[model samples]
Target: MDLRDRTHWIFDLDGTLTVAVHDFAAFKASQGLPADRDILRGLETVSAQRATEIRTALRQWEADLAHAAVPGPGVIDLLEHLRGRGRQLAVLTRNTRANALRTLRAAGLHAFFDARDVAGRDSAAPKPAPDGLFRQLALWGAHPDEAVMVGDYLFDVVAGRAAGTATVLLDTHGRHGHPDSADLVFSELSELTSRLATQPPGQSIGGPHASQKS
Candidate 1:
């Protein structure tokens, strides 16, 4: 569908808006987590004290990364387009609000969003859960159908699906990821902008293929 016409746009911060800089494997190693395990999920298996320690380390790591943040290619253009159209925008990230704002400012993207529109891990249950998205929608006085969740990973897609919003996977690597949950996929944010600009509001944008079930 003409996603730009969607009234509210909820985006993932780290990989989707800012360039992906997280060395997840190294971070997991540092946290004494298994490489294959999701960091938040893995933390649940640890002692409460250990989990707290890991969380502190993760926050530090994200803070460090935020200082060097750069906007992903086409991020500025897409955001400008959305803003010009007067669309409601917000960020829903697993990162802390402070870090998300830091990255946005460093990337020169902070002006496009209001602080109240940003939802960090502290604001709601993190992605793969729909709470953050639901909270954003509620704040905007919007229904899920009037919004779309855009992100670069499976959690983003799953969370959007669970929230009943359309999902767009920013699969820059052409991995064909999160097929079942994502309603659309774009290798670049510019592609999303281009399609949205050219298509009618209700028209569908074709995708490569849907995800295969195991």
Candidate 2:
């Protein structure tokens, strides 16, 4: 159960690596889109023309925000620690792959990951689908038990769990606002960095199991 020993790390891009900049409420409101459900899923129910408009706007907005992207507290150090271990890493995000790479580059983390390791909406079904995680793990020939999914929201937790990977909640700023939703929880990424940096090998971070399925 010691997460530091896990060989493959799957991270959510926005809130986990970069500070969350997407204000879904404001963006959807400005787009005249409904606020009842997931934005990407909602796009499917709209007219083709309308969806195209929204998507174009979305890509532009994401581009601007991606350039302004900042790393979450202690994220750089966390990534450095993981990379130093020679472990496999990947980003499973709800954004387009181009935007994800842009964000990583702007946040000064582009070198830690291979471009092929960043899985985005265009490459998979998105969070809660587990498809992105599955594909990335397959690419590495890694088992779900060897990976840990770190993210900052309920969908991330759901996606990680569905993917059969151990999940860590990076809930800085209290935005996640939930309880008992992840295999491990940390209020800031710095704390996770400290934990991983100091924990002895084979020591459990928490939980009684790694990520093996029954």
Candidate 3:
């Protein structure tokens, strides 16, 4: 479980890397949905009714808000450290590729990843499905045992585990429900940076498990 030896680092967007300023709730508000609609409940309801359109609107708003995304605490320094260590990195988000690129560019982080390295909705089914992670692993020519996933949500852990990649939970609040599959959990990006210092180089970051079966 040494993190330093990890070759590939796949990341999630939204609550994992940046605070969502224009999420489902914000989108609903902009669309003139009930002002008092329960954010979480309303999403599931609308999703079942206007799945395609809701996804489209959400993607558009996410792109527009990406330009406004401020870097979460310690994100830049952590990424810099990882890059310095020669780790390959990529972003796997549920949004459209266009929006993902726009967000990263708006945050002045476009240089950190390639268009291919940033797979969004264009890749495959979203998180909790593992298709995107599997595709990324295939694209990188990396074995499941050589990579790690850093994310903030349960879906991220689920996808990572399903891909056979070790999960590193960025538990900002220390309150999110624990993921039984996570190999390691971090409270912040800075914690991840510090922990990486102790990992031995060249050790695998993932576990030995079948991926395609799930």
Highest TM-score, which number?
1
RMSD of 1: 2.7
TM-scores for all candidates? 0.93, 0.92, 0.80
lDDT of 3 at 60: 63
Q: Which residue runs of candidate 1 sit more than 4 Å off their true CA positions?
A: 176-180, 207-214
What is candidate 3's CA lDDT for residue 198? Answer: 56
Candidate 1: 10-residue stretch with minimal lDDT: 205-214
lDDT of 3 by residue, 40-80 (tens): 33555664667566666766667678879766788888788
Which residue pairs collide, candidate 1?
none
Tens digit of per-residue lDDT, candidate 1, span 171-202:
99977544655888778888888877777655
* Alpha carbon lDDT at 151, candidate 1: 96
Per-residue CA lDDT of candidate 2, range 102-184, in tens?
Answer: 99999998998999999899998999899999999999999999999998888888998999999888776666555467888
Q: lDDT at 170 for candidate 1?
A: 91
Cα lDDT over the full model 1: 0.88
- Report the Cα lDDT for candidate 2: 0.86
